[model samples]
Target: MAEITASAVKELRERSGAGMMDCKKALTETGGDLEAASDWLRSKGLAAAAKKSSRTAAEGLVGVAVAGTKGVAIEVNSQTDFVAKNEIFQGFVREVTGIALEKGDDIDALKASPMAQGGTVEEVLTANIATIGENQVLRRAKAVSVSQGAVIPYVHNAAAPGLGKIGVLVALESDAGVDVLEPLGKQIAMHVAAAFPLALDENGLDQDTLERERAIATEKAAESGKPADIIAKMVEGTVRKFAKENSLLNQLFVMDGKTPVSEVVAKAAKDAGATIKLTDYVRFQLGEGIEKEESDFAAEVAATAGLTK
Candidate 1:
């Protein structure tokens, strides 16, 4: 048998558009022959994922898990909604989410981490793609933690126990017991799902987003055609209002539509006899950014049939 170097496997993977692990296995099976490995991948349909990779994967589940004071959320995307109903796919997501609780918010680290069942997460993901016959991607993940209080997890309209279209995790740092923290954290997580605040606070909001808001405020202020300093004040006032409305802590509570989230936390703490600080949170809506392919079914079927006939 020929020795298969890392570069050899990489070359094969690049040529065949198969997964890294699949390319290595193919090379090993074919005695380190690149052409033969590519052929093997094609024959096994493992290369199909690459062919489908260009298509949008906008349908899938968001999985969330909480272990003690730490919580993590993951978004696993597939090209079709059918994949979301697959038991194998759901199981894979659940395992990955469990791994994520330990892996934190770093996507690369989470993908490289070892799975409980077997192999690295990347290896398992490749295997799942080959078996499940869909181009599935572990898109993104986030983690929120509290030093003393609860990191509560919530799934909105869950398809499975901890898997759903929306997942939210809220971290409450407090001297409060689990009994006091759990319900409070859950209410906050629920609010996160509904409100979809851009960030926990103003500072947490991205610079680009802030700039965009400022630009809008300036444009609107310019339309008023007021004095220069007056326009500047208008912009500032608009931006301050924008910040408060978009920030999680400053947003009015969805449950009551009057009290701000920060005040609600304070009230919860006062009622519970503890100091509860809303520390951090993460919210994932499945396929939040991906663009899906849209086409006419009849046209697609007719095109697939025969143009020569």
Candidate 2:
């Protein structure tokens, strides 16, 4: 039997949102495998599906820039939120976002690209770290563009003009003019920020995610003592529901809370007397997927003083 450590229990609790004892027991039952423990909790109806986005604790800003029909979103991480507020840090993020808009979102390529001021993007970042006196990273960038329509950008909880905690870009392919596209695109971008859709459509949902949802649903259905065919149908329905809830096009619009996003776009196109298609979108939330270590200040201080915690 594998030993389940306190840190393992803490991690399982964070991942599954189960109680301490429940998480500990799940870890024990699953031989201390974090992923398996999560499944165990979900199967027992002790926890909801884990959402990676909720784990965000890193301090940073997500910057956005746009040119005609093209937009880019970038994330720059810092060791502390105080650093994220610094003018120097924000300026670097904004400038690098512009470079990404021009070049592309490849991390290495963007880092290697020359900055408008002087040195390469990576060099500027290094200089900023020394000047700001905190460690930082050029985490990631994503670009979205359309052949003809408007690409709109929005920042949520903005720290500056184009820098914020969440950056979103919506690419619309249509014959509609900016007068029609800009407002609509911005609304959709805001939706992307608030809704946090996993993908643009059903086809874009990850297979692994779907399988995991299916497994949970199967375990849940089996608990009802239903027949095999009924259990299978129940599992399929649950998976389909999960897809509809997480897919951008299928999700109900946050604005109206009733109309599907696809319907919203279609209605806007009808009103504009033109064709509108949502081609692509980029939603960058700062620190998403990067786990920040949780520290106990009291415990550390006690240990440093050579006292028992």
**Highest-scoring model, lDDT:** 1
Pairs of residues clashing in candidate 1: none
Could you give candidate 1's per-residue lDDT for residues 185-295 as a string of tens digits?
Answer: 788899999999999998888889878989999998999979999999999988889889989999999989999999999998899888999989988998886777788
In the range 155-197, model 2's lDDT, one tens digit per residue, is 9999999999999999999999999999999999999999999
Number of clashes recorded per candidate? 0, 0
The TM-score obtained by model 1 is 0.92
**Whole-model alpha-carbon lDDT for candidate 1:** 0.88
CA lDDT, candidate 1, residue 211: 86
- Give the lDDT of residue 42 in candidate 1: 86
Q: Which stretches of candidate 2 lie over 4 Å from their true place?
A: 1-57, 298-309
Q: How much lDDT does each candidate structure score?
A: 0.88, 0.87
The candidate that achieves the highest TM-score relative to the unseen native structure:
1
The C-alpha stretches of model 1 lying farther than 4 A from their native spots are: 3-11, 296-309
Task: State the displacement of the C-alpha of residue 53, model 2, in Å, after optimal TM-score superposition.
Answer: 22
Residue 69, model 2: lDDT of: 88
